[model samples]
Target: MAETEPNPLLRYLVSDPDAFAHNLAKAFEQAGKAAAAYLKPRETGDTDFGSTDEITRITKTLAHVGEWWLADPARTIEAQKRLVGGWMDLMSSTLKRLSGEPFEPTIRPDPKDKRFQDSEWNDNAFFDFVKQFYLLTSRWAGDMVEEAGDLDSHTRAKADFYVRQILAALSPSNFLMTNPELLRETLTSSGENLVRGMKMFAEDIAAGGGDLKIRQSDYSKFRIGENLAMTPGKVIWQNDVCQIIQYAPTTETVRRRPLLIVPPWINKFYILDLNPEKSFIRWAVSQGLTVFVISWVNPDQRQAEKSFEHYMKEGILTAVEVVEKSTGERGVDTIGYCVGGTLLGVTLAWCAATGDDRIKSATLFTTQVDFTHAGELKVFVDEEQISSLENQMSLRGFLEGRSMSTAFNLLRSNDLIWPYFINNYLKGKEPFPFDLLYWNSDSTRMPAANHSYYLRNCYLENNLTRGRLELGGVKLDLGKVTVPIYNLAAREDHIAPALSVFEGSRYFGGPVQYVLAGSGHIAGVINPVGKPKYQYWTGGPPQGSFTDWLAAASETPGSWWPHWHAWLTDLAPEMVPARQPGGGVLEPIEDAPGSYVRAKA
Candidate 1:
């Protein structure tokens, strides 16, 4: 009989016995390191790995979901039937494929789901079945949460968010055995991949202080003021809370009114000055606008007592004062991004109440004044969670940056979390160098009093929109902010939903031009004029519902920067000889992208 060739599929079962043994031994050593890293924090009295409060909250919320399903037998039966029916169809399809008969998949992942992009997921019967089964179950679970009519909106939102996370974690693509690509890598490398992966896993845990800070990008590949925040500028003012950097003039003539940017303390301000190509700050400067950005300090125990009121006073108001002193302009144009935008709104209201009109025009970027439709982030902001977080913060005097970073990552776990997990730990590969992810990983700590006040007043009570919020002993009324306002919202923003932003526009007392941009929170705002990857929409006013406003809006191609500049010019069109940093009044403290932004969390 002729010799039979071995099956290609079975090749993974065979390996060089000595090489396999060697890799296995090395992998064990790495595993020991990982174990030690995990326990190091516990040895230091930081044993709250799986938070009891979070566990209890999740259990109670899931129980509420269970109660709703159990309350009606018909609903329960319907859900089981839906899942079972999906499985039966998937099984049928698999059987047909095995018999060499043409058959369609019982279900398909969303087009945007990158996890199932591997061809083997569709070509291989086993993986196809695994993918289909997982999708079926996940869909059934989501349906149950959505149909739980008795549950309150918050509970429903929490359940939905949690279910999605669970499903994302449980995806077949996350497992080496179930993921064809990982299995192939493991087989071809004779398990050497696992050894390398385990070593990296240990190193990452140690780097995170036993908290497992997954490296989203090669941190060593980038550095602030060198390649990342490389925009030319000088730190002209400094306070305990922040360092205000005034960028050097890019043009011979610049806008008469200086531009002060109030970025959120949740992250560093360098996001706006990421690079020459993508930097919104650099682009704004090139557009002949004198730009000053607040680089918020990474708060520690010493700064724990700083409140939201302190940020308003020492951060925004102080930056405004310094800008006025430096530029010799009493009135200036201001732009705020994310939570900073929220603070700007409050400042505008406070200014309105106090009869201060230094903020000539206000531009808000993906900022939320109303929490009613605030997206998935609200899941982490309920009374129970906030109280638990406050308790934890009280012990440390500040909330760890990783906690917030983790929460934000969880909001898009499929895209952000699981991909890195599979790549770094299963494939033994380093994440590609990405400036945005680098900035994202570089997070900032939140002051205890400041974070607590924000959660309670904004997310918990929805105080700002209600005109019930007070700061500096003055009540803020959004309706009284009569400054000509330009409100920009990202259509797909998870942090600040377009609907929520639109609702906020109605509260402003001035003429508001509500613009809807493409993409999510970060990419939406940092869109550069040189490279136009997304489009934006412009409507008369943010009237009626967001859906209606979008329907009647005019679509414009490319970045929203030029449109914003045009609006700024319309507000204050005068151009003057460009002023250097410090304006010969406030002495330059240091080069731009100063020490404050470089401080690690």
Candidate 2:
């Protein structure tokens, strides 16, 4: 409308002339007050800190009016001059009246009270208070400076004026205002949002103070002993950064055999193998299947040479060898969660590249293979951001865990960083403790090579989906490997959107069962028990591709684990007798869940 030269007032408010006049009159009055305040200037001078002694006493002595020359008559003399310049910039900018005057309080200060009205025409105590306060403050500053140590402040002008300007900006009689709606959401009742808010605020203060500290804790209800595997029931191998445990056989285990879990390095693997009853690892173990899980070594700065390819070569592939060597099996069924699944996909690519076909079947949980759909994370993975990250990785040799966590938190401010910041930083309170919060704070590091390559190729370039991505110099052709693939996508995952997970299905060229699980990323993958209210969606081998399957399948709500179990069992080898093959001795460690307990610092 403005571009069209159509008067905005004529279009939206031509019919309300009376309202226009009244509002316009009020606006002019406020403008006049603001302009008056803005034009009021002040002088500037010394600060509370004393002048330099080296440039001071001699300078004052040099300023004698009686001595403009030296004893030689052709003497040299120097004069000192210091110049300063700045402009005033604060004032009330609410509204103005047609008379170019501020609104005078014609009404009582409060209708509910009787003693607050003024009796004269220029009776605005607000502006009067401002003028009076500025005068007194300026005088008091000068009067009090001599009592202070070797310094001068009252000698400075505009010092008190700057403070007054700030206070004026916040006055109800002034312009700036607060957002009511945003403030309300954080302070409402019927939920702990209020409590959560206070803690976040506290954390901000603690963080700002540069003393922010994070310590891990043990939250896992499940535990195992040094003789846990030898106990004839269940077993767990605990490490400084991970806990590995095997479960008892279930009815479903009879159909499924040699189930091994591969979890991501970003966090502990126990998320998938949460507990005996709900643990997917335990569920597989109990179902008459031999289960083994790989626990990743947490690398600090010293061990930063590990890369994504290295993880595949030494981590997953080695775990497969260990599992096979112990069971005397040529291959074992596998399940990968999140980046674990990402690593699994890369491993398959590596296998195909090397003509090594050892993996029989694979399942991916909330794992993304095609990076194009990584959503908001895209903002932080452009070429520039990647370059910045590369420089950062160059500095640290890898991306630190806290750095990744900070990036993840920023993706969803309300859900992660802000809610607590408002309560803790703004409101000044302590952070309330929660299991999820505790887990979220427990972070792990990534190898610099892995971090840089993953960010550049997968995220910035979206190379995996574009068919432009290569792993360890080998074209990662997900379609070349002909192994059965199962994918469980969380219905409401922010990190790994379900549809994005489904995109990887097109890269695989075998029987693919894409299941949409009914939870967020980790919870959905870790789901075991047939929860009553869960839901899922499934596609088929005949659906052509992931694209075709989505077009054909209908949505259903319930635990999709049953269908997954059936699908995995159909592809897995039948169970064999209990036997131990050529395996390393059970290295006796300290206690059940030792390292993780330490993590619970």
Candidate 3:
């Protein structure tokens, strides 16, 4: 039997078990040294003040060790050899369907499916063994204070502080140093990295560590267009994230009615309206779809008081009112992605719960209505992380785009985060200026109140889907939304697990279409036509269950955008004849894709 295709996330995770283990061990080792060196007794009041050379040596040593382990020549070859075999296994797994292997679900089937979560629970059980391996080493946690404890804190308070740091880092859950057989070897090469990280953090006040290189001046190029005027295109309308100017097309030119786009605040909105050529908004316009994108205000320390509720009011709702009033259109088709999709879902529910169904149809791209099985992120979304983020946002008015970007990057350390570090910091090479990275680095801040509320409610509490999340003083029951729904999810996305996203199909009633796209989190949405990229598959208009649908779904090549365009063309209000700027649906004074150009980070 032919093997089944490998899940990207799993492939990524198990890419090189040996190398992964090796890197982790090295990281640990470097971290250990970094910790020791950083915590080494500094002569109190002796103005040498810990020479920069000392601190930098520790950081470089840690980074060097981590990089070495991550890209170890022998390790890489071994990992590659292992992955080749794994790929064959993966291919064999994929071919099984053709060879008539009964079935193996892409995601663990819900217990409701009358089935176990996995066809192969044994492997998961093994991983569970690996994870739980720590508990087996109870002596490790209670083991003598290993590295930093050796430091002469020279005072009780200092010693206590050092002890507290050790306790915080060595919790049973974070006890990565346990099981000397498994991880310590890897740490041997990389342990100093961790310690160095701590010291750098400790000395940040003096070092201006605030220089988190979130935005690269030359990293990404934000290209401005010559056609500054908001013009009707294959799309209906467009808004700016930078909110540089407020210019909706003029009324006389309003023949092309507005279709407003709402993107998740978690990311810069330009992803949808990326650029003229690859721009989805532009594509929509070319198809004679009137598009107006909501360019969210990138908050700063000044905007910390803003709440999620305030955003909806000033964000989508406000945009709707402004567009409708300008174009004299009674309703608008609202499209959203990720957080935007969630927001869109909540907003739609609010409208329905309140009996305000002004929206035509709702399209959710890679958005999850349910948060169960949020995947690897569930580990990091701990209460403390949320609180730390909330406090940060409290002072900054929102979590800086860089902080959020860093968190997401960590999810795919080998791919997103480490590769760049290796390329730039390790090899002493400049990273090629890529627009996506630029956009990514150009992150926007969420208001403090809203960011905190979102993390606690959506991630930590998982309340939004559990029927507990209330927005704008309204209980956001997704079941309340009656609008025809279009949902897209990426099969390989670790960020929003497919199973979690499939839960959307159940929440939103009405004719629902869920399409599994070919790319990862961001690439899926950026899917352009003719990329000959990943194939998409769909189940049924009358979908049975997520599993049933997945099984019955047929595959389609290239991006889902074309299919969406076709589907949307069917749903789209017939295109009004082309009109001059501000002639029909547009108001001349407002902007096109406003508020998108600011330095997000």
Candidate 4:
């Protein structure tokens, strides 16, 4: 056989003199077609710019830009003045430092910011200079961004925020060459760290699309039933969507009304049962409350067709039935976290509408039923993003856990994303096996139908609060729910803002004890009474706004768990002798942290 050349396109390009000219003509022809297609609708007086919010935002941005253009002379003068003052201050500080005089940075790092814990910044003058200069540059850029009146709009502000984040992430200070400590380590290790970092990068690229944040060995340090979710309990009931874990009683007698906890399906239920020390389940059991938690299954294409109604029926309603049957009681106190709380609210509304009295009282943890002021998370749950996500899920039938995690991480990129990037890639070191980080890295997939319905009905359309959202054939109305409510909002929660969480109180007709916790979402909820790290505030229900409520609220110096437990105990029935796990229609299927939670997506 005769030898034949490969890559016909390459041969055609090189062999034919006219090929280049022909390709250029073809490219221009395609460009023209695309342009005509895009402009044809506009030419015919037809156009859909975007949603009302998007159009308003774009209009405001343009107006602000025009205003800035008109005020350019004054703004330019002000900016120059500020820049010169900043540089002069820097020069003075440098001279004082050279003379061995005491000097401090004007803008010190926030105590919460853990990015600069290394001692080198203080020990070395050169490193101090670089750090100070970087701060000055960042401040100048931030001032410029603020001065740009376009950022007045929330959408534009968020866009500018992320752009700054990308720029900060690409800063030289994060790399080995600019960082003094990394440079020293490279010198001492003879570039071994660099080799190891390269290897780690390659592995991450191959395995996780460069999203690896934990050491493979660290994952082995924890397991579903062994180290994590080790609270003494049994899987009393289970169905296709979720497993109900009934914790073994720790007291001689327990409260008459059993407690049912509905945790977010986005995370494993083990967050409530991480270990004996921090496990909310263990603590609740100790408090003489019969605790039952719903552990959702990590779904695959097999369950992608499952709707939010499916979750309400199979996840919460089924668990309520089993709990009531086992305890021989008609009513149970319900507690929900994040989306779990949102689901719990919907269930309560449904129960009230149908004259079902299974839920006696309700407690919501960092939950938002009203999406009006939903904080930073609202940036991701728009029409364009949801449509794109739907397309991806249509192929796989579920949203991949890792991909979803990336969006959540970006909400607090400096705290969560960059630190991991530096530790795993720049430092070439193994990540310390922190239990919370492990759980965060272990994510669960969202079923295509359920997730799409949730984003559209609850988030996009804001129907749940508007009395338009229906589930399991019941028209949910939060106003119909008359049970006493205990609502907790975390002050620093980026996912569900405290104001958004508090807004749900307006929909309920009953007495509500709204408490503001001190920390972020997960940390605020997981705060144990014994170790009480964050302070909480007790307040009357929503007054005028979150700010007004905060002004009137009284600060309490410890965890909100004690207050909640007390309120729960006061409402619950008289103490009765403890009962064994699994009875009635429900039988013990497995240990507490069942196979469902352990199943990988």
Q: Write the per-residue lDDT of candidate 4 for residues 1-601, one digit (tens) a residue.
A: 9988664223112233354345435444544544455455456654322246545544554455446635779877777777777777877887888899998664555567566667766556666677767677677766665667644455555555554675568654588766776766555555555555655655564345323433433566888799999887789887779989888888999999999999999888888888888888899999999999999989998888998889988999999999987889888999999999998988888889999888999999999999988877676676777887798789878988876676688787777777766776666787777898788878899999999998998888999889898876778888998999999999999888888988878999788889999999999999988888899988776768888889889999878888999999899659999977875556788887888989875
Candidate 4: C-alpha RMSD after superposition: 12.9
Q: Against the true structure, candidate 1 has what lDDT?
A: 0.90
For each candidate in turn, the TM-score is 0.97, 0.60, 0.62, 0.82
Candidate 2 on 375-421: residue-level lDDT in tens? 44554555545776676667657666666676666555434654444
Candidate 3 residues 1-601, lDDT tens each? 9999785234213334565566546545654544444444333321223236434433443343334335657755644464455445445544564567854522232245211222232243333333333222322322212222323322222223233333333323232332222233224434333343333333322222223242222342445333222233322233322231223322322224457778777776666655555566656656655566666666677667677677676778877776565556778887888888877887887888788867878888878767776755564455545665565555546665656676676565434544443333222235566667666666666678877877788777878668888776778787777778888888888878777788766877677888888877878777777454677887766256677878888988887887887776677445454443343554454345443444435
Indicate whether candidate 3 or candidate 4 has the larger TM-score: 4
Clashes of 1: 0
Report lDDT per candidate.
0.90, 0.54, 0.57, 0.78
lDDT of 3 at 367: 82
Error of 2 at 458 (Å): 1.4
RMSD, candidate 3, Å: 15.8
Summarize candidate 1's per-residue lDDT along 80-117 as a digit string, tens digits. 79989989998998999999999998899999889999
Winning candidate number (lDDT): 1
